[model samples]
Target: MTLTIRPAVPGDEAEILRLVQALADYEREPDAVKATAESLSATLFGEPARVWAHLAELDGKAVGLALWFLTYSTWTGKPTLYLEDLFVAESARGSGAGLALFRALAEAARGLGCGRIDWAVLDWNEKAKGFYSHIGAKPTTGWEAWRLEGEALDAL
Candidate 1:
C-alpha cells in the first residue's frame, strides 16, 4: 500500500479530531480526550498558538495523524519537536501509515534544525515499543515522566 504524508490544512481538522479520539480510545483513556472539532480547529488553525499536524493518507483517505509542537531543550540549547499525539486507525495499521507519519515528523525536525524528536509510549503498549525500537528509538532509561493535574496543575 502506498501512503502519502502531508501537513494538515484547516479543512482536515475534523478528520484529525477523529483520529485523535481514536488514539485516546486505543490507549483506554477515552475520557482524557477533551478536544472537539471546533476547539481543535480554533487552536490548530488560529493565530498565536498554532499547533502543527501531519496527516497520513492511503489511497487518498486520511488514516493517521501526528500532532506536534515545538519545545526548548535546555541541555541542547535548541528547539526540539515534541510529538503530542500520534494515531493510526486500526484498519490502517501494518500498511506503513504510522511509519510514514513518523518519517514526515522527522523530516520536519531536521528541516527546522531541531535538536531532537521526542514522544512517549505507554508502558503497556508493547507493539508500539517494538516499533519504536525497530526504528532505532530508545526510551530514556533513567528518567521518569511526571505530571501535575487537577487543581495543582491549574495553580501552576
Candidate 2:
C-alpha cells in the first residue's frame, strides 16, 4: 500500500500522456485533448518552465497525474498553487491515489508560502464534487468562470 508522489521527469512522458487521455475519457471529451508528450515535456522540462507536474505511483505503477503552476493572489499578496489537472485512473480512484496527489500539491503550496490552492471541476462531475467536498474544499458561489478563446481571443 505504499504510494509515492514525485515530480514528473522527462522519462515519464508516455505515462503522463496515458493518464491525461484517461482523464479526458472520464470527462467525456476524449478527443478534446490535443496535448502531446512533446508539448508537455517542453512546458515542464524546458528551460524556464512555466508549469510543473507530479506523478503518483502505486506499487511501482503509474496511476495519477497532478499538473499545476503558481499563480498570484492580488488580495492575499501571495502566490497560490493552481492545480491545472488532477487525474487518477479508474482502477485507482478509491485507493487514495487522488488523495495522495492532492496532499502533495498542498505540501507544494505550503513550501512555497502560497495563500491557497485553486482548481475547477466540471459542474456535471458529481463524483469530483464529492471528493472535493470530502477534502474540505468549498465552492465559490458568487464567481463564475469566464473564458476568452478561439475567435474571440484572436480578435482581441
Best by TM-score: 2
Predicted candidate 1: what Cα RMSD to the true structure?
Answer: 1.3
Q: Which portions of model 2 miss their true places by more than 4 Å?
A: none
Q: Give the candidate number with the greatest lDDT.
A: 2
Mark the regions of model 1 whose C-alpha exceeds 4 Å error after superposition: none
Each model's lDDT comes to 0.90, 0.92
**What lDDT score is found at residue 77 in candidate 2?**
98
Worst 10 residues of 2 by lDDT: 1-10
Return the clash pairs for model 2, or none.
none
Question: How well does each candidate superpose onto the true structure, as a TM-score?
Answer: 0.94, 0.96
At residue 19, give the lDDT of candidate 1: 90
Separate clash counts for every candidate? 0, 0
